[model samples]
Target: MTRWRFAQGVAALAAVLLLVALWAGAPEAPEAPIEALPIADVVSERLTTLGSVVGLAGSGDSHAWLGIPFAAPPAGELRWRPPRRPEPWTDTFDALAYGSPCVQLASGFGGVSDQDPGSFAGDEDCLYLNIWSPRFDAAEVPTGDDRMPVMVWIHGGGNTIGYAGSFYEGSLLATRHRVVVVSVNYRLGALGWLAHPALLAGAEEGEPKSGNFGTLDLIAALGWVGENIEFFGGDPDSVTIFGESAGGKNVLSLLASPMAAGLFHRAIVQSGAVDTVSLASAVNYTDEEPPGDSFSAKEVVLRLLIRDGSASDRASARFFAEGLEDSEIAAYLRRKTAEEILSAYRDEPDSADIRPPRVIRDGVVLPHRRLLDLFAEPGAFRGVPIILGSNRDEIKLFLSQDPAWVSRSLGVVTRVRDGARYNFVSGMHSDLWKVWGVDEPAAALSRSQEAGVYAYRFDWDEEPVRMGTDLGMLLGAAHGLEIPFVFGHFRFGDEATAKLIFDEADEPGRRFISDAMMSYWAEFAYAGTPGRGRSGGLPEWSAWGSDVGQFLVFDTAADGGIRMSTDTLSTQGLLARLEGDTNLDQTEKCELYRDLFEGSADWNQATYSGLGDRGCPPESLNTARSD
Candidate 1:
């Protein structure tokens, strides 16, 4: 290990030793005094919206202001409402500590740590944001009008289980790239998206009563940055909004929403598709149906009413709810705690309502239609530079969650049947879902808007998987794998998983990838183009329009690191390839087809419409539904 790494290890070991000694009641050891850290006063000489904030400096001269509240506490009457500005305070708000995460389901991730003394795993009053900056002087008191480009991060946890503190550690990016970094926390799960007629009835005049409170919260945070980021030496006008998965989905919503027109100058959507359900469909959530279709707040409320014995059945609950006066229902809903409301959707993991469609087509925070459809329209979104990307093995994360699904899909009966075919199918699925989801919208943006749209495919597969399991190969640049590399956060998430994903041996490759990725990202945030500003010795990244249909592939290679290539697969293309391979028997082809199409709504739709154009028999494309 390098000297810096060795020192970190020693410090960690010393911390462990200290903890053990304290637990064992051993004699106290002498305290080793350390030098004080550098700090920067983010408060400018001029008056600002946020009174003042001081940022503590880290190893690379990067300064951080943690847990700054961006909005008023969204509790009580504001539980499911749009976020409001925080009341200005006279006292200086200390931002050294992390703010509480919005109320969410328990995740095995480190953010949900009960062990941490002041961890806020499930707190309702959680509309906070954090900032990281590279500008610091000898006194480290943010001494200039030097405005650094800003990158605001929105973390991904299926819109249910992540916080700004969990996934983002921005010092590396800020210092290395000379950019300002901001990460935010918004409401999650039911608390974030709950929409009932009672709540709608209580809405103030001209206020949007859409169930997308989480989205509105993000808009408010962006507005806060626009109004107050100058104090932190940040150029709010050059802000780039980037996020992964659910966060990426939010970025897409922001692009399509009129309210977010002037909030950000650029956007990056990673592994998140532009898909949404209508408010009518989401509020009518149910459990009897399969996934993706049913996501009803009504069902949850029904379950709540039944659990509390307030109603005998769905009928009675409906009668009581529909029959009651708007004020009465509102009063009853407001009485229920966040925990009680979240409990209704916790037990059934397979239920359609589990991840209810938080992105609503409510014509307020979002457009009154599918995001993809909006992108298709000419001049639909703001003409901002955009980067759309997805990992190679995106489906592996979901497959790992259900090993049985993996086994059935891949025909892994004994000794993992046909590994090559399994890999092919997995790749095909990633392309169909993510590439089609991301690339299509990118193409739409390129055709419609003047701003450039860039595409990327994260293909890093060098990390070692857990011993005795094929997760390493299975999770080749899976859904969330690119995030750690992008943020230079190899040691993030839980310790065990962190170790599994980022081994010590892979440090060189990881570091190389991190430098390249951060350079590209920061460059994009700064100059509207990823390859234009301070490239840091990385190769050129061509824009999507220039290349027609190519993507920048991220991986470690001896010849060249990042290469441009086309994501070569489609729903029909894969089936045609499988059919052409006469070496495989009909049974194998059928099984592959079944796996590809079963509960695979898009593929099923294509096959139902007739696969004759793709040289596949309609009867041959059979699908089997598996749990």
Candidate 2:
């Protein structure tokens, strides 16, 4: 009788276990095949306003339509002008490959390159966009309430480099999250942001003359999405624009731009700051009394004329350039090859990188007011929900390559020369970045806009120790490192580069964090608030509040997992912290202060002068460092 009772108890326990398993449920299955959707047949063709486009198969049950022109090529006569709608075509367009990247001097770090670094790559006619969506049949395309939210990605390279290349492929994000992903290419460098008066001599009356042609390119791309995203199973009314670094800066520009209003519903800026060029800085000669940018339109023209043997020296070149009529100057500039025009503005004598003034505040495209001021004023800028974020060690990416802070072996392996000094400088700079890019902006937007303003600090730094190098300590949540995690892509550059930063041992934690980030991003796109993420199972991400230091910290379980924190940063607070530190001498402190003051938007001469009277001149600060 006891044995019989035991058997019955065991059966009851088994039943309960089965019930629990049913309630908990299993993981979502891999993406469904096209045939599984409620459609008559699979169709990879999409009819757009420009033409009918056929897409190719993409990773993980997604379809990709690449090289679709949204605007007329901004080349020759169209250069430096607002983008116009592309001429329509009758034949079916094969959008199987990406368009040429916008013209830029190649950099192995961010810019596109097939040749050696510093060599020029890409083309003048590169106003195209790529789209990725879940594979669907023609008859089963989602419409009306079922249409998915759309996300448009803007690549970052200081607005001078980068392209919508394969490195940022959107298949994983789109397929996994059930959202439409679009990546765009815009004009870069001087070809996109020149503000010479000669180019505007015969401009039409209502045309934007702000010399922010790159900004206009984004506006035009959003316009395209608004008109035609429905054909790709996306809702036109629910568009979110997101970017990193300079791309994030562009997102902020769109928020400030009256021309870009109503084009996007939400925005996400990852490590982006507010910086705009003045009209004088964009057009004046560097030698003028108030002196313009070293690579201003006039300065570049002078250099080009000298390089062409039309003038012997700076004084003579300026004289020759000033002698030309407006029409003559316009004709002369147009006659120069793209290479000649680009090479004239190299950042260094031997480097092909050019850092010219961009996003001009010409009182038309962008308001004359500053971004923070505009955000503080109700209704002055777009009131959409915004997510502002920065990495924990934002400066480590650049500093890791600097010879002053680190030593490299064979130009591949690297080690920090002075760990304490390296951490101190990187931490301070990174904190300042948060002050400018995330905290300050979040506070301003929260005060002005009714929509939710969210803030985040990405703290996932799990790089492996390879070749006696501790990558985690060296890079540690560095700038641009969060990009792949956001997109669920781990592969960047060759296998060696990928292996150096990511290790198979860390895969489980890396994927967990990536999944959490994507969930938060997609949820925000869907409802303008990340809330408890898509599943409503993660930690709640509260919007910015009146209290201090409210933000979601993204990390893995091994490193505290996803949680909220109350740690905040400010210019005054950072200054105080720096003053109290005993790790560095007065000279070092002043040098660091110089860099901070130069980078800070709240530059105050009085505050800088009060720093120990260490003889640090505020004039020594490089105002062009942000570029």
Candidate 3:
């Protein structure tokens, strides 16, 4: 079978087994509306350490400072270097509109744009942040013990796309929780993560030589918060950093980073994993004796050379690139435009699907040790309160779009072809995600740290079935479905898209869950723990213990409400269960095993090969390694 068809079949089979217990039934009736703070005009000006900033009106009783520059533009000579602080302004900076999103291929899912998907948009001068806070007098900046807690958000798009734009507006979160919210923009794609020996030749001796520039940009934003947050009524000492998906991965990178020490007191990682590329893989060519990634820096340069007519073919390009000195190579790469650099890695001219390695293990910005090892090692990571979680049906979001499992009508509405298989496979992948992203880290951190290490599983799946589209089964508590609940903002994409997932019939439950999540998140930011939420009248969220697997289950009253669960998962247990399963044939079982090995950080070749006659071909393993 072709790789694409094999992938679909595996997804279908794997998803069938995991959806037995998680999906909740439809609610009986609409409940009471959730009570919220009154909306009123508030102060919108603040004087930062750099200069004055004038903000604009926001939703409810909140003020929004949009597009406030935290760092100088990382353009031209600054492209791959660490971010620098913006120059002090003489005039009051007009923080009324959002800054341009960092350069990325536009898509329906990430970044801000009206442009068609796969088209290029955004700008390199995108080192800016947006802030939201409850209304207060301009002269009365909260100080000392009275300052509000600060929560900085990092948007997620595989660390390749997304920005601090309208979809992630913090006004509702800020005004509702009576706290300060900040969202930042960072460099992305090849510009943000390329690592090569040539590029490091002229670099400074410290973290600048490390090619984890996107990670550094986040650290720089946190540094800005430390110096200037008090003017916005936010306490720097009580700062919390939170993100979803790629943003969550960035948070994990920060936790593992020695450079980010004491910058933020708490962290929340949602559906994120620990991953980084080796220096050899970052700099080598894919066709070399010891092959590197397809998008390695040397390979990218060769592609650029061919694209620009500097060479006629791959062999000539390789000969030319290798003959050049490190300085010459660096200078040549630095001279290319952002579009030119990005075009070298495009799989399709009209598809934003490039997947280059990110978050390099450069030993300076991010330590050389594995992330889980750092967590287990005392004094390696900041032992602050942290929450790690994943959605119960995370993989459904992606699988629902796959033609092998789901079919769509009118190019919008969708339906699952085989609900049993789809649910089972999605569940397995989602469970594995939880194991990799949430459980493993929580277990490691809880064993080492004195500070609270909490865990959660989002299980709110109450979408109404429109026409024949079973959104409850199709979307469920899928990836990124919890983001709106966390922020209490349900507006995503256009009106029809929003309505398809979030129905008016489920408004009360949606509001209920969103309020609880916000309270728990805000309370965690205020104190070290989320005990009984901010109101001190919800279910007590116990910390993850070293012995038992404990985590709060977030759902509506109809679906068991907010409660605690002790069901923890591990790779060994999952593999054993897969081995014993009678539902899948030998080929299907091997396909699932292949996916598991491919997705895992701790790959055990012996264990995989021990699957006996059910094992995949040895060549498949080699292909996986090369890719």
Candidate 4:
């Protein structure tokens, strides 16, 4: 779109929005006394740190500060380095439009991809953040007596895709919950993650030299929020960090990172699993890929050099790779454009094959131990109140998109019927998530901080998917289904997916679930306990403990809405039930056990041994195990 047309669109949107703000009794931008000067057309506000005004545009009840820079653009020589503070400007900087997402693949491969219309297809200078607040006018800015809670959202795209702007519109949470919502944009793909000896050559002696530049970007945004949110009428001391999927995993990382202490007061993880790699694994290319090498920063640099005709053969490439000085290699790597480095990982046939471990166990930012091990240690976490949970059918999103890939990833080659495959995949991922992602971590946190950890399961399956089959049956409570509900954004993304996932038929359940979630999440941000100050008749959510693995199940049932339940359906207990069911022959039982749990990391050796004593057939179990 042309600049003229874009400006016209902005004016039209702002004009329509003004009517809503007026109806909502939102204050006009102040003017008169210099301190009370109000912004016009698109409502705007000035932050305390920069003292530069930013225009707000979006739906009326709230003002949106889109594409606000938190750090200097990490491009050119700054490509692989930690974010530097953005340069201050003397004049108002227009934050009227959404910023481009960090450079990433256009489609889903390793994780969910952001395909929004203005994800502007991707860029290198994407360290921007967006905010949605109910009060943005100078007159509405809060004084010492009345400050709103702040929620900083980290969007999930497997740490490879997604941006801060369009997909995660925060109006509903801001308006309905009376909180300030900030969604952040961080670096993605190889540009955000490539750590090498050369890349860290000139680093300060004792600093973190790991590749998790994406994690650093997030830390920078949090630092920015803690400093400037008060200018937007948000209480900086009451900040809550929340995310889903990869974003959720990031929340876990922040909790475990020593550098992140005091940045956020609360954290919530939804379907987030943590995986860390050692510096040895990242730089060595020891795992398998093409040419008998792992997909790492070394391979990416080699590809760029070969593509540019700097080195014609693998031998010469190896010569420069191993023989060159660390500073020399760092300089050469920094000189390459963002695209040249990212192109190496962009060509895999499927996302499943190429998802190399990205979060590293660097000593400075992250500890050397695995995340789960760290969670188990006393006081290892930031000692903050936390909420963690998963969907009932987390794997359905993957199965619906590509069953073959889902099956392979699930480690199943059984020729079971489609219905059975669906049941197996969904049940397997859901149970495993509860065991590892939710319950275990909650149990650990509970031991450290009593009544400080909460767990939940989103089971609302009334999505109005327009696909041929009933969406409730096909998608169920799938991965990311909880996100739109949390944000109260029933319509998601560009076109058909929104209509398919939520339509008139799904309004009642959507409204009910969204209201409850917003109330629960926002209340936690306010009082550090969900049930403390809520007047909305929300269910009393209990905390999870080692012995008591309680969770608030979010579903729209005929009898009651949200209810607290115990962990009766433990992974081992569920497998035992499948084994003891007389209706299923030995073949089905063994196949179900092996397909659903055997090869998974969540598998319990003790439970498997008990099942063997329960007369599960040796042959069927053996066959499924062989693959």
* Steric clashes per prediction: 3, 0, 9, 2
Per-residue lDDT tens digits of candidate 2, residues 1-627?
A: 111111111012112212222333423234545753222112778888888888888888988888899999988878767788889999888888889989877765446745565688888899999999998887788999999999999988777778887878999999998999999999988888888888877466777776788999999999999999999999999999999888898999999999999999999998887767777777889768556777888888888888889999999998898889988888888888777777887756677456644688878888987787789898888799999999999877666656778675545335789899889888998898898889988988888889999999999889876555677887788878788899998865434356556888989998988999999999999999999878788899999974554899999988899999879888889988888888788788777877666644555666666675364555565544332
lDDT of 3 by residue, 550-594 (tens): 999999988999999999999888888777766677777677777
In model 2, which range of ten residues has the least summed lDDT? 1-10
Candidate with best lDDT: 2
Cα RMSD (angstroms) for every candidate in the order listed: 8.2, 12.9, 6.0, 10.0
Clashing pairs in 2: none
The whole-model lDDT of each prediction reads 0.68, 0.80, 0.79, 0.69
lDDT: the better of candidates 1 and 2: 2
* TM values, all candidates: 0.83, 0.90, 0.91, 0.82
Where's the lowest-lDDT run of ten residues in candidate 3?
A: 1-10
Candidate 4: clashing residue pairs, number: 2
lDDT tens digits, residue span 1-627, model 4: 111111011112122122223333445544435554324334456655865757565576788788888999988777788888898888778777777778764543212233432122478888999888884567768867588999999987667666675668898789877899999988886777777778877666654666788899999999999999888888989999999877888899988888889999999898887656665556664433322225666766676677788789756777667778888888887777665555556444333212423577767678878887788778766679999999888766545544342222233221213665467546765676677678777877888764388989988888542323445755678777788788877545433335444678768877888888888999998888887225548779888867778999898865356898895356766676665555556555555566566534545555554563354544433221110
List residue ranges in candidate 3 displaced over 4 A: 1-43, 204-207, 287-291, 408-413, 599-601, 605-615, 623-627
